[model samples]
Target: MKWVTYEAGAGERTGILDGETVRGLAPGTTLAGLLAAGALVEAGDDARRAPTEVLGTDDVRLLAPLPRPVSIRDGLCFLDHLRGCHRALGRDESLHPAWSENPGFYFANADAIVGPYDDVPVAPGSTMFDLELEVAAVVGTGGRDLDPRRAEEHIVGYTFYNDWTARDHQLRDMAQGIGMGKSKDSAITLGPALVTVDELEPFRRDGRLAFEVSASVGDRELTRGSLATMDWTFGELLAYVSRGADLTPGAVVGSGTVPGGCLLEHVDTPDLAAFTGWLQPGDVVSLRGEGLGETRQTVRPARPVIPLRDGA
Candidate 1:
């Protein structure tokens, strides 16, 4: 089942993607609301009645499947990405083996999420803006101290996530013992549709992520890795997250950068500034995965504001 939130003649409403049209589920209801009400499974199955007016897929604008999540935490689930990034930055010391013992993640701004068609706005003075190819599970059932064995039950569906990054800000923040919050602000994008967890059973592969993740900037392919490479399973991550907090409906847990997904893994900062493949205005980034669908965003650089200072 594919669920979406879209804007139509009536207004922004929740719907099911059926063929080339979006069939409305109910007015003023969103995917998040449906999840909270525990009506998603039932709502999607029974949304066949005619809408006030059916919107052709082209006539409507798709929003993030869950427009407003309670929280967003993107995790570094693939070792190849970590190694590649560190190596690109001239690091030789290997990460401690203990670092991979448990699933790890960084909390992101939930309010920063945009939809598939929205423009990705680059932060001003960002020397390197990159995209992190990811797939995220949307929470359906809320729980505390969730068992790893039962974590699957809490997942409602999956969506493609583009974790946009401002590399200049990220590295600077890290140098001062501050977090990377500024570098990751106001740019995460997701959507097109949300595919239910049941729809992905064939690709489960004994419960570890196994979907192929792909990304491209215009005509150039940047990544061709698979979720099969994840060092940690969603169950383990969820269990770890739930240890001290409650997992709630509408929360998003993201798989971090797949191998070779971002510029940070391919080029050093000085070299990247001169690289044409690094995202610039009008560059379209297309991200896709097996069964998870695709999301494309056109990059738009922040308008430059020349700094003014009084003559010394």
Candidate 2:
């Protein structure tokens, strides 16, 4: 069942997406509640019961599918991405052979997430905006120090993620041995809908999830890669992250960026001005997976600001 958080006349509520229509759930609805409610309603069912019984399309504004996630973790699991990016930047020496052997990840602020339809604002006083197309999973059960072999059981479903980056800020922070710069603002865009594990099981073969990922800016195709290229499995990432830490339900974990994923991996003489050269106001970024639905976002300049008066 595809789930979503959306806004109607009644305000933000959880719902299921059926075709082009949306069926609203109760206010403050949650994945846990749906599970507890047992009979998860279909979007079509909700649509049939809408005020006019015709599905209120205008009332539906898609929010991030999962509203109140407990935690969000992302993994750098793609090896081909690392190699291709490093090679593109002429920095193969910085590439670590063991990156694929061990899982690398980062924590994302769950509360700060935005939906696929939301307008992404570029950072002010900055010109180096970048995008990373990724596939991320949501955890269904809470566990600690989980064994890698059984880590799949903890997953609830999958969603598309665009790990937006400010390249200039990211580089400065990386130079300082921390990742604060790359992770500011509404840097993470998640949703459209959550495709459950059962729906994605067929895509997994020999213990690895396989899916094609592609990204585009307007009519320009930016990157294309597969989830099969990852060096470490999602299980490994879950196990590693769960060590001595609680993995709670609704926690999202990303599958990192794929090859040619971002300009950082594809460009040399990395600079903000040069990286965002192709991006202009009103450029649409579309990311799609095999089964998961597509998420399209338009790029817009950051909101203008006025300078503060001295000693105000």
Candidate 3:
């Protein structure tokens, strides 16, 4: 089932996407609301039988499948992403011992999520704005201290995610040995639709999602890789995140940037260095997955920053 949240005339509405048409759910029914009620699948079944309204996909505006997520935790599961980044920065490329022990992740700003087609603003004072292409899973059934073996059951669906970043801010913050709060809190793009786990059965390999994902800036493609390269699976990521904390319905977990899925990885690569650079105003970034759909956004100018320190 392909679940979607969209705007058409009245207000935000939930529905199921069947090819090019959208079959509406009960009035005012949202993906978040359905997940909280633990009736996401049931509602999809009901909509399939008797829809509130049927409209063409082009007739409405597609919003994030789970707009107001309870929380956002993006994982760093791909070994190549880490290696390539280190190689680019002229740093040691040796694997981190802790990375193999567990799937590492960090929390993101849940309130800053934007839709697939929304415009993303550049961070103020940022000259190295970037995009990280990934796939995100939305939790349907809440749980705590979940076993990695059974964690897959809690996933409701998957969607495309763009972890927009301000490289300059990220580097500065990282130097301080703290979280990447200002660097990534500006915006997160999600959407097109949330495809249920059952719908991606054919693409599953060893219980992990195996599909090609790519990113493009306008007409030129920058990065392309498969999701199968991750060292840890979503189940493992969920298990680690739920270790003493609650994994509630509507929480979003991301499969960190795929190998070569971000401009940062290509910054020092000879072949891509000439064509790729920090995102500029008017640059359109498009992230696409085999089954997860596309999330495209236009880069907008950054808002002026308020002065934190006085004096000349």
Compute each candidate's TM-score over C-alphas: 0.93, 0.86, 0.95
Residue 82's lDDT in candidate 3? 88
> lDDT scores for all predictions?
0.82, 0.74, 0.89
Candidate 2 on 1-312: residue-level lDDT in tens?
577777766667766666677666656665556644443444325534662222455667777877656677878887777776556545654665566467888787766687888888776545667788998888877789999999979887888988887666665777898656544545588888887787788889888888788988888888888788777888898999999999877788999898787766667553424543544568888898788888889888976645578654
Prediction 2 TM-score vs. true: 0.86
Report the C-alpha lDDT of model 3 over 1-312, residue by residue, as the tens digit. 999999999799999999899999877898898889988878988889999999999999999988899899999988889888787776788986999999999999998989999999899878789999889988989999999999999998899989999887987899999888789999998898999989988999988788999999989898898888888999999999999999999899999989888887876663433444889999999998888888888999999988788851
Pairs in clash, predicted candidate 3? none
Worst 10 residues of 1 by lDDT: 268-277
lDDT of 1 by residue, 155-261 (tens): 98889988999887888878988666678985888887888988888887766757787898888888898787788778777888888899899899997888888
Q: State in Å the error of residue 69, model 2.
A: 2.2
Deviation of model 1 at 63, angstroms: 0.9
Sort the candidates on lDDT, descending order: 3, 1, 2
Candidate 2 clashes between residue pairs 3 or more apart in a chain or in different chains? none
Pairwise TM-score winner, candidates 2 and 3: 3
